[model samples]
Target: MTEQNENGDFFLKYRNETLFNDKNSIVQCLKYFDKDNDQSLDLNEFEQLLKSLFSHNGNSYQIEMAKIKAMFDFFDSNKDGKIQLIELENFWFKIIKPTLFPKNALLIVDVQNDFITGTLSLTNCPSKHNGAEIVPIINNLIDTVPFETIAYSIDWHPADHSSFIENVNNRKLAENSPIKENIKTFDSVIYEAYPNVLQILWPAHCIQGTNGAKLHADLKQVDAKTDSLGRSVIYVYKGCLSDIDSYSAFFDNCRLNETSLHNDLKKLGITDLYICGIAADVCVAYTSMDALGLNYRVIYIQDGVRGVDSDNIKKQEINLVNNGALLIKSKDVYDMVGCKDRRPELAYATFLSLARSNKV
Candidate 1:
């Protein structure tokens, strides 16, 4: 078999020989890679270890010799030419374990009643897709996928939120605003108060404590404090400030203010994010983009999202893919999470992260 086709076999062999073997500890594994039996890993032995860890799913992974040397030097503390058992253990726990078994999270964004069947219903938008159609699809993922963390983002807007069309008169319109009179919903206007704050106006919806702000009744809500499965549940409330609008769960549109989502996921050591929810071109797209920016492996569930505009959604999908976001189906998530159906794209993403960290 070619080197590419041998990747799966190599991984299985490595798992059986090193990871699953009860007799082989971290020190033993390091010694096994020490071809000369010198009790420590030399530069050549170290390169072999990194190659095996990086190559997965029939991908012919490659790295410059200079980078491999840098990695070896990094692990070889005290300016030692060889990697000892102590150094190998640190590398195994910090890098190898995370690469092999990543912590995954399912991020459900803005699946509220208002976007589904109320004032800001997507059915009335250009695409006219039923926003409620995604609820069952997302619920199935929640029930089946064994994700380490589940996060639900809510658009918790105040009654006088600036994005509301009715509240247009509340803020002074910027001089650059195109339409000043007879302001309508879906109109993009720049507000003078925030200094060039361009916002898309929508009907009054998702006000705090209102039925519109609540998640759809059919949607499954996991309690963060008491999850039966011991999974971490997080609720991220965005657009809470009346003056600024937050499309991404992590940060506001201007990126001036941040929510608790990034730190929450970081606290749990989440490495991958499977994002799906309403308005694919808006909230879902923004969240996915931000997740990518935050160095999270983003897998977007294609069928589990509904958008306001078909053209905009297509454009956003292309943009996401160009920026390293993986577009996947809901069905593929189970295997991907379980590591049964490994993807080269995700593997490459992980490699890129390690390479960029300058530690390897």
Candidate 2:
């Protein structure tokens, strides 16, 4: 069982603490994970060690296998594919203790079935956005990356919501002669709630409790039950207000009202956010912008996101990088995270473009 201090804070017990704080523990753990009993650990061996360490004593933190592999690469400074015993010892004291012990959150935006394969499927979307392709990537991340908090931003809308083209078409059909005037999908309509606000009507999707609103089968679900450390996955429903559309996880499009996400993160003491999900040009872009505005250092996982419009997405990427969001490939997450300076290395042209762009 885990141990607790006098103040009721949970921590590693004396025996466990000594094991982690010393080099012998590293050597022992390495041997246990090393299936061949070799002094060096391969990718599979390294991954098993990570899973064991994090899940030890019912800690219940989910970590991605890829990040574990990345961690291994960082330790294998000799550029060898396998991690030597001495390399494992160096990692425990120099990297792992300082970098990953802090509080962090992983924010996944709109990985629902609707965005993947439902009416609003990005596969054949206007920009031919293949949103479904991100599922396996994200699932892998969920399985391997360890974070204090896991939050999901779901686009839940009522059937009569103003953003639906069907509702707009129905209203228009009633007021106009069908033969003379017909409203089609993707029609733009102005709602009186926010006058002059252009509401790009989408196919009705993610209605409250519908199957379309559910998360994709491949995505891992955090248990509703909190672990011993008081950690569990959080679900934040946005775009529920009938009149307005909410793209950012923190607030509506107009910023009229905010979601519980900001307060929740604040309470959790989350200083950094790792963001990934579907529709990069829209939801992911907006969420990254808001996170930067909120003073939270944002890291955009490039491989873990898909775009609805390729052109728009390229522009959005430039804009996000300019606005202080660090762009990184998913593989770089483990190594890059070990440093206090999180600025990503960029080419001259990329930096210049980012410096000039103001909007996503």
After superposing all C-alphas onto the true structure, candidate 2 shows an RMSD in angstroms of 13.7
User: lDDT per residue, candidate 1, 48-126, as tens digits?
Assistant: 6766555545443465687677667776876679998888876766556555677899999999999999999999999
What does the lDDT read for residue 97 in candidate 2? 43
Model 2, 74-165: lDDT tens digits are: 66878879988787777565444433344567899999999888988887676877777777777666666666788999999988877787
Model 1 alpha-carbon miss at residue 299, Å = 0.9
Worst 10 residues of 1 by lDDT: 1-10
Candidate 2 regions exceeding 4 Å error are 1-102, 169-183, 224-231, 338-341, 344-360
Model 1 C-alpha lDDT versus the unseen true structure:
0.82
Clash number for each model: 0, 6
TM-score of each: 0.78, 0.63
Model 2: which ten-residue window has the lowest total lDDT? 1-10
lDDT of each: 0.82, 0.69
What's the true lDDT of residue 299 in model 2? 82
